[model samples]
Target: MNNSHLELLKKLADEFQPRTDVNTRATVEAESTDAFATLVDLARDMQNRLDQQQNRIRQLEQMVETDELTGLYNRRGFLRRVRETMARAARHPENGILVIADLDGFKLINDHHGHAAGDAILRHFGQNLRTHTRADDFVARFGGDEFAILLVGSIPEVAERRISDLEKATSRFPLIWQGAALPIRASFGFTVYNGKSDITQLLQQADDAMYANKHAKRPHSESSHNAA
Candidate 1:
């Protein structure tokens, strides 16, 4: 019963037993029983509220650490993890690879198909990376069409092969946008970190390598014209 009904019952029971006399013992027992029931109901309601609050907190935590669109780790989350990994690496130095990649012709795609299509392609790319990488590997969309991956316990050669595999995967897979198939490709650059280099330096090196790869792949005529 509701609190109001329980209160009314208690009132009637009290009226029947004005004082705690032995003659009204049965009535007092009934009133006490009703009060205990109300207390039990209140406790249950409070527990439910507490559980709801805990669930909300968990959702908030996930939102803080994850990108809403691609479901990858956000910049903040990625950096935090990098720091932790670096600390561990310092304790036990091993081969770790950092790879940076950017979607080729992404600007054209965005310009032609609009941001929605661009977002869909990015989400697809992120899912592909997650599928190919191991559980120990870290992947995040740095921003826009750029992404970064940290492969733990991997050498430079393995890193290169993995990145090449990723590029092939993306190139072969066509992203469907608005019932149309859209071609996508990516360029990658990677550098191995030996647990002694600064994170910033490692990122810069990877970025430089990515640009070098991009430049190397450009047509000779374009390069010559740009030089002019």
Candidate 2:
């Protein structure tokens, strides 16, 4: 609600309230039937306004947490959820995995294929990630070419297979931009999290593992480039 409407509500509330100095029973008796009905209507109107304000706040929060390009949660939203997950894990005997994936050769693609292709790649990969995961799982785009996935109630072996499936699914459908096919590949690393884990440490571990996986692919990638 606008400030003017808020002030008017306050005024209505103040006008309807029984004064402390007045005799309560006499004040109630002095108010006419029409006055009591008007007071009830005003109270209902104020409640509706308050409900609208709450809804608006929720919508704004959603916008803030969302990534504009990929329609996924942004980093801030991801971290907030991670913290909540951590808190829940502390309270229960649960386990989960956090995966950080970076698009390999993203800078090269952006430089050679232009920003539009880069954006398409990001959007496509993000959608694939969301499609492959369950509704309860968390998926986020942590800006640029980096994304994260949190799989709840998962073991390391299951998490590994899930990541492998995601990698294959994302690359299977190459993005077509400007009548040219642009293949996408991302390196993924994951860390298991439970009640005792720290969020910052978990993220660093996942990032390091992802980089190691990327490095491991370098030899094959270089060989293909040479053959081409």
Candidate 3:
């Protein structure tokens, strides 16, 4: 809610409340520091305004970090948060897993159906991914049709399970847009954090693994997407 609205409500509450047989003006005069009290009130008012400005600034920052399309973190937010998470995971006993995912036949989906339909699928898939992953896990859209999920304090099996669940989810629910049932196909490759000094190298490793898996399975359907 807006700060102005909050202030208005507070004003109404103060007016409605019943007060005892004590007068604010008489109290101020008895204190013999009316000027000082006024200064304190001014300072408090300034502080409230400052607090409101700070809250607005924080909201704006969150908007910057979020992806407008899918409500996931954009690449910048992903890198910023995941870097810290990975650093902590490196020191902790349990390691982390990074999965690089790309949608197969996404271009075709965009080409056949309008971009609106394409966006709908992406939003649905992104929300589903958010629901499926653990709360501590970080999910982000790495631009275009690519996404990344960082499973903090997790193992290879957790990443593997996510891939399997993703495949099963898409298969189970055929996305329907404009009276046409469309398949949400994707490919995923996972790389475990091995106490590497650089996190980008781990990302590169996952990307390479994804392509290798994609190429190896391309023969079956040429465009068949795999969650393997």
User: Could you tell me every candidate's TM-score relative to the true structure?
Assistant: 0.72, 0.81, 0.77
| Each candidate structure's count of clashing pairs | 0, 0, 0
Candidate 1 or 2, higher TM-score? 2
Off by over 4 Å in 2: 1-33, 220-228
**Taking the tens digit of each residue's C-alpha lDDT, what string does model 1 give over 1-228?**
899999999999889975757758888898999999999999999999999999999899778978878999877777777888888888898779888887777777888899989899999999998999999999988887888888988998888889889988888888988889998887788888876868899899998898788777777766533311
lDDT of 2 by residue, 18-96 (tens): 7874686667767876698999999999999999999999999999999999999999999999999889999997999
Clashing residue pairs found in predicted model 1: none
- Cα deviation at 212, candidate 1, in Å, is 0.8
RMSD of 1: 11.3
For model 3 the local lDDT of residue 224 reads 45
Off by over 4 Å in 3: 1-33, 90-93, 194-196, 220-228
* Top candidate (lDDT): 2
Best by TM-score: 2
Candidate 2 has an lDDT of: 0.91
What are the lDDT figures for the candidates, one per model?
A: 0.85, 0.91, 0.81
In candidate 3, position 201 carries an lDDT of 87
> Tens digits of per-residue lDDT for model 3 on 128-177?
77888889889998888888888887778867887899777866676888
Residue 227 displacement in candidate 1 (angstroms) = 16
